[model samples]
Target: MVSSYPVQFDVDFPARPLDRLTTAFRIIVAIPIVFLLAALTNDTVQGDHHSTFTFASGAGLLFVPLLLMILFRQKYPRWWFDWNINLLRFSNRVTAY
Candidate 1:
């Protein structure tokens, strides 16, 4: 007897070989995207020499805003909910990559 799983996975591979240039500069090419992805999580890139203003976002999730809206108004605004939902989705994509 055999047990069955709830889900199945599969992938289709291209017959041709992978491109060399993209493979070589993949990291460099992905740098911009990484930065943008990080923004959703409030990632700040620090450079040499300090300045008065900083753009660092709170770690991981943006909870403070959600908490504030809920506590003060007793409701989670649609925009806030949407932002969080989309952020979670983008985060998953980055991890899957």
Candidate 2:
């Protein structure tokens, strides 16, 4: 029997041949995007002497809140779901690249 899932994902293959140079150097090309994703998500930088903490304002998903809500109230807010899904999509895209 067919089933309807709450969420689904798909990616289409490229019609044209993949660029050999880009394919070979994908890691180099993806460096910036990976860093961007890291900054968006939870990323920390440390120094030897003075420890400075940096966080992008309102950057990460509502993980703790969502977990608490699910555990205590058995609820998942729509807004939080949207935020998490979008962030996940960005992370996946960066990783796939």
Candidate 3:
């Protein structure tokens, strides 16, 4: 008796490993600094602690995901790459590639 079957193949794509620590460090450090500067400017203009706190809180909220991504980056490279690629792709403003 002979049996015939179609063969299935899986292709593995090459990917570069990103440094989670660096990504996290940038996100954690840079975002807040930028936000803080903006908030300081607002404070200088309006002279209100409430606005400064609001901006700081918002910045902290934004920072959380970046911190998490950095912490678990190795576990989700595809997600990370997709996110970064999409951002870069969109930022270029040219759809054609």
Candidate number achieving the greatest lDDT relative to the actual structure: 2
For 1-97, candidate 2 gives per-residue lDDT tens digits of 4559877767899899888887879888788988777767876778777896766535545567678888998887888778779989998878776
Candidate 3 residues lying further than 4 Å off, grouped into runs, are 1-62, 72-76, 94-97
Per-candidate local distance difference test: 0.70, 0.76, 0.52
Ranking of predictions according to lDDT? 2, 1, 3
Each candidate: RMSD: 5.4, 6.3, 18.1
Candidate 1, residues 1-97, lDDT tens digits: the string is: 4449877766788788999886778778777877887655654556767844446554345577678879999987898768778878877766665
| C-alpha positional error of residue 69 in candidate 2 after TM-score superposition, expressed in Å | 10
Off by more than 4 A, model 1: 1-10, 42-55, 58-63
* Per-residue error (Å), model 2, residue 72: 12
Residue pairs with backbone overlap in model 1: none
Residue 80 lDDT (model 1): 71
**Model 2 segments more than 4 A misplaced:** 1-11, 43-77
Best prediction by TM-score: 1
